[model samples]
Target: MLRRALTNQITRQQFRFYRVNRSNTVINFVPQQEAWVVERFGKFHCVLDPGISVLFPIVDKIAYAHNLKEVAQDIPSQTAVTMDNVTVSMDGVLFYRVVDPYKASYGVENYGYAMQQLAQTTMRAEIGHLPLDRIFSERAQLNAKIVQVINDSTVKAWGIESLRYEILEKGDIHLPQSVMQAMQGQATAERKKRASILESEGERQGAINLAQGQRESIILKSEAEKMEQINKAVGEAEAIKAKATAVAQSIQMISEAIKHENAQKAISLLVADKYMDAFSNLAQKGTTLMLPTSVHDPSSMIAQAINIFDTLTTKRKDMKSIEASNEDKKPEPEK
Candidate 1:
């Protein structure tokens, strides 16, 4: 009975120890930005979050530890052929983060490396679709397209969240000497074409400005001539107005003076004076002169001059009477 009892006690102690060992396994404090994949007998059991955790000692084991942090990887330079058949080498970097640790561990082998290769291959394929010049001008678009492609291909398989892919540099494209010479010639021709275009534009603008200036000058000259003509017309009109006014005043003074009793004697005096002046002018200015047989016949010359003056006066009175009659016969403007 004592030996059986001791064996029962030993069996009880072993069972308790086994139970403790099986249920008590402590995982040390995990970083806040890290996670661990837990597996039971090589199969997925649960995901271990941050902080200490306890699990069944023999059945549950930490399968994989993953860092939930951002990572940057450099892509090595690789040669790619463009659509133009130009071979160019390029290098870049990629930024990614692990979203799901279980998938990161089990989805693909070497997630970081697989992503790098994917990025390279995708970039090459993208490069092959574009011309050489387009590759340079559309670098940002190219990087974005590469990132999208890599993410699309790797998100489910590699569990990697591709944030960005940046192309750092592209090496000089290796080309045949003939291609290089052709490129150089093409560059020279393009530069010359642009320069000629600018020069022609400048000349065209200058011609336009010169023509505009000449047009303005012509307009100004014509305006000055128009003003001069206007001023000359005004001056001539004023001179004619003054002459008419003087003639009217002289005619009025002659008509008023003709009522005096000495008017006939005044007329005879005026005629004799005019005859003397004419004789003096003829003797001084004429190349030839005719002398009357009776140069002393002053009375006869006076009588002839009086007769001509009277005939002119009579004609003037007749013209005045005709003008008055015509004015009376015309129709008047309506009031």
Candidate 2:
């Protein structure tokens, strides 16, 4: 009976030990932007998200931990041959992010290394298709092509998205010394050619503008001269018209005065006075003078002058009577 009691005590101790072990629990604290992959019996069971996660201690295991963040990878310098058979060394950077944790874990052994190799190979292949000059000029297009090719192969299978690829700046692309020297000379020549063309164009435009200015100046000067001549002609014509009007008014006044009875006597006295004035000034104006024989006889000279004036008046009256007779003889219109 004592042996049976000892056995029962041992069995109670064993039950207590099993119950204590069964009460134990496993808790995991997951950080932000992280994914913990759980495997049950060597197979994927579930993914634990950020926060508290409980797992069975013996059966559930965290197989892989993945950081769900964007990453940038630097590409190492490598030599590539262009289609024109020129060799160049270049380097760049790549940007990417993990979209699916499970696929990233299981799709490839090492996605980062895989991506690097793919980028290098793609870059070389693209460079091979272009000439050296075009390779530099079309760098943006080359980067886009590389990204497209990488994403095409990795997006679904590897759960990695390639955001962009950028080739490094100036010093990243290295050419041989001889090639660089030749390129520099070519660039210098091209710049000189452009400068010369611009200079010639400027000279041509300046010459054209100068010619146009001269033409305009000539046209203005000719117009001004023509206007001057026209103004002078108009002034001369106006002077002649005014002089003719004054002469006509004076002649009309003289003709009316002559109709008075004492007009002839007044005219004789005016002729005598004009004769005396002309004879006195002739000695001061000139050394030589031809005087008529009757110059010493003032009365005789006045009588001669009056006779000539009366003869001219009689002829003027006869001409006016002839003009009136001619006007009367003209044929009238058959009104």
Candidate 3:
């Protein structure tokens, strides 16, 4: 082993003197997502990319090495007072990456600590501009504003790119006991008010429905009554018409009988029969006393009925004779 070491040293020295040591130089295998800053004689040089690269042992050296992968920084909780004098402590995580290794190595001493501090300061300032209610509701906006402020100011000069900022914990944000109680009471009152309004609306709808139903019921009933009355009146009118027709038909038959000069005698006998029946009914039921008057005799009643029929027949005959005479007086149509 000692002999091999001596041989390797002689070989390296020979290669260096003959200007062939570049081939034997140590090759740096930079892994993916990483960068190496090579400096020649303590001056700025090119950034070494992925894969194998070499720097002269005596001249060029890797001055700075940086991992290009994303980095996360956990920020400790800090108290922040809001515009309305509400104090809240908040903690978060910040994600960043080295965009320019030269600037990251030279532009700032420590970009991670600087990013953390800037994030805190910006967070405090942003919180101070907002009210307590907004702090709870606008957490996303708060994180975005903090990221933007840090990225625009310190992160830009530091060659560090801010990817994201997430609030890990929202520390206790306190309000006065009286204020909390008052808010709770207000919420209760609002809920009760809504319930009352809904109940009243339901009752109003019920009343409207009931009134409409009653109105419809009344209208239907009135229509039914009107129809019944109309039907009754129509029935009465039809009955009157049928009775009149029957009466007229009976009169026509009587007139035919009168032509035979027997109608008057028949009517007299029929009237005497009806009087006998009515007197018999009165005597049986005893509804009235049937004291017979002097003119109540059946023979007398029959004689009177006969006289009345004769007078009516004579008047009818006279009217017919006058009608015949008038027809004869009218002029005949020329044919």
Candidate 4:
């Protein structure tokens, strides 16, 4: 009776302990998988309080998710290198999380470890090549490069996915305001000097243009005056030529008229009328008049008429010779 009682109690205790263990254990451990069994078992994998699980009890597979905050802090500052092997440093914050749970859990020893290691090295390399100002100027470029380097190096291997990064604060870099102000002032002065120089050049060019305009105006006006004077001289010369031409035409007409018998009769009639007027004027003035004393003295009238004809012919010939000589001595026409 005592042995049976002890056996019953032992059986009940074992049942309770098994039930408790099965409920509490995160990974069920059993030698066989059964559809109706409350728990199934396989080789147990360590789950990081929040890591991976095998979807099938008997199938060997691991999958999980990890929060970045559960693993490590955001990256803030980092270092870099240059081709010359010089070291340059900068500060920034890094953000990352697990994108692939399988890789996050199994592909790498630690996701945070890979990110940190890569971030430090890449930051140093990038910062070394760039001047400090470029890195310090803005977070946009710095974050992109940091995430790129981290993702490229670790996503395939370390299971790290870079979400974002940012510049925190400069670590060793320093700039003095006085020096910056001096640089700004120098730049301003240089701009002003250039502006002043351009303005002076423009003014000088304007003055030169004004002088040229005045010179051109003077030259044009002088040329106009010269043309006017030349025109005046040409006009005077034309007037003189016209007068001389008229005189020549008159002399030619006279020579042609003198060849006509009627013209000779007209001239003789005009001379007789002129002699009558001269004789009357001489008689009124009591001047002596040469004439025959009576119609019987015919030889005296002929002698007086002969003397008057000789005097008039000599004077008329002298006037014609003077006119011809004047025509011969004139300058040639302008070409």
Candidate 5:
């Protein structure tokens, strides 16, 4: 009985040691940005976070180990028809991360594969809604829409959070040869049209500037001519006024000289000399002269001139007396 009792005690000790070793074997040192999904007795259990974690040797099992870091999945190239009925083949990348390990492990067969397929389908659907031109121009908006669609479909169902979607650049989309040629032609025509418009605008502006310059020049020239004409008119008027003043002064001096007796004798002798000189010039010209029948008498001609001068003086005195009488006959202002 004592030997049997001792044998049982040793078996119990051996069982305890095996359990310790088995538990040690199941211990996990999880790294950062990782999660381990645990199951107990083939049922869902708690998730093992980063750092040291222990599990029941037989009851607990690491069902799925998920990396919490973001993942970039390449979408396979596929052809899709656009709204305008043009076909284009395209490929891109999808960025995602596992947020809930529990759902990621059980929600879908494979979350990464599901995300890739969803992204591709979403891209094709979006392409179908847009024309070929819009597809190329609206890539950013297309990517954002794709990301939104993907997250909406997979966030709650697959525990996958789509960070973003990006269509690769550098000719990722392949068009038909005919489409490529057509697009090239269209681009060339657009550039030519813009160049022609710009050229025409430049010529129009240049013509306007030239016209303005010519107009200004003509206006300035006319203004200068007008000023010259005004200056000439003013100078001519001043000259006429000066000539009138000089003539008036000479006439007054002549009248004063004729008022003296000696001056009258000197004027009569000057007239006789002028009459002889005139006859001498006529003889030199070899022209016939008509005389008053007293042609040889210088005294007769001087006396005739003196008599004409006295007659003109007598007429002037008579005119002044008549003017004075008319002035006295006019009515005066009332006192």
Candidate 6:
């Protein structure tokens, strides 16, 4: 083998060596440093950081040794979930810091592709359980749930966490406006029925309360009237008792005074006035004083009549006697 001056590659000199001589010199290359994989930078090439440097440059065919840890950077934190086997394309961003460098590097062939496959599979499983309505309407919420599910299994082995998600495609629940109107009508009918029931209950309760109030008013009024009647009766009884006591006292005083002749004579003068009043009342009522023909004396007739009237109307005579006693209190004529 012929080697160039600077590079380890075979130059045109090696070609000329092969053309001139079929078999001339046998040569082998002895590298000074370990081989490493390199990617182009602005002006220089830098090795990718992982558990160790990967894709070391070698002399044979160019072999790109991929570290799962370095490639997993493209895997986003957000995962996409398809609804009921529906296709969806979405983009997301992930924030990740390598925790287990060794596992990220050597756990899988391509960590990004593995994570994407895992996310896709998890999305399918999660969205398969939901209907089109939920998948389209609650896409973000379902994505979070699916992300959590995926995280449970992946984060431990893959050293990645699902941060957030976005949905790019959707399916339709496809409810018609006529169906919505029907639902609204049902709700309105239910509300109206409830309102009617409540109003009827209120009216019934109001009537009951009004009736109870009227009954109470009537009872109170009756009680008040009874109390008033009782008070009036008590007042009348007290007045009557007082008047009887006064009359009894006056009669007792007159009886004591009548022990003497002078008192009797004074009492007789009172009787004369009482006789005049009685005659006046008898005349007004068309009553006649009938003199006894056997007695033939006006005074005797009066005394007989008084005795007879007292026997016939005892209560009336009792009042007349009280009136006569009261007349005794008036001034008499000259002695």
Q: Model 5 misses residue 283 by how many Å?
A: 28
Please tell me which model should have the higher lDDT, number 2 or number 5. Answer: 2
What is the RMSD of candidate 2?
Answer: 14.9
Candidate 3: tens digits of C-alpha lDDT, residues 64-159 = 778888888877678888898866778888888888888887787656666777788888899999987788799889889888888897555878
Clash counts for the predictions, in order: 0, 0, 0, 10, 0, 5
Q: What is the lDDT of residue 81 in candidate 5?
A: 97
TM-score of each: 0.66, 0.67, 0.59, 0.38, 0.60, 0.39
For candidate 6, lDDT tens digit of each residue in 233-286? Answer: 999999999999999999999888877666644665566557757766876887
Candidate 5 all-Cα RMSD: 14.2
Question: How high is the lDDT of residue 299 in model 4?
Answer: 47
Worst 10 residues of 2 by lDDT: 15-24
TM-score of 6: 0.39
Which residue pairs clash within candidate 4?
30-41, 75-93, 75-94, 76-92, 79-123, 79-124, 80-124, 80-125, 81-124, 81-125
- lDDT, candidates in the order shown: 0.79, 0.83, 0.77, 0.60, 0.83, 0.53
Candidates 3 and 6 compared by TM-score, better number: 3
Off by over 4 Å in 2: 1-26, 244-335
- Winner of 2 and 6 under TM-score: 2
Candidate 1: worst-modelled 10 consecutive residues by lDDT:
15-24
Give candidate 6's whole-model lDDT.
Answer: 0.53
List candidate 3 stretches off by more than 4 Å. Answer: 1-26, 54-58, 170-317
TM-score of 3: 0.59
- Residue pairs clashing in model 5 are none
Indicate whether candidate 3 or candidate 5 has the larger TM-score: 5
Candidates ranked, most accurate by lDDT first: 2, 5, 1, 3, 4, 6
In candidate 5, residue 194 scores what lDDT? 100
* lDDT by residue (tens digit), candidate 4, 80-134: 5544443444565667765554455557654554566567677776676665446
**Which clashing pairs does model 6 show?**
36-56, 36-57, 37-55, 37-56, 77-94
**How far out, in Å, is residue 267 in model 4?**
8.6
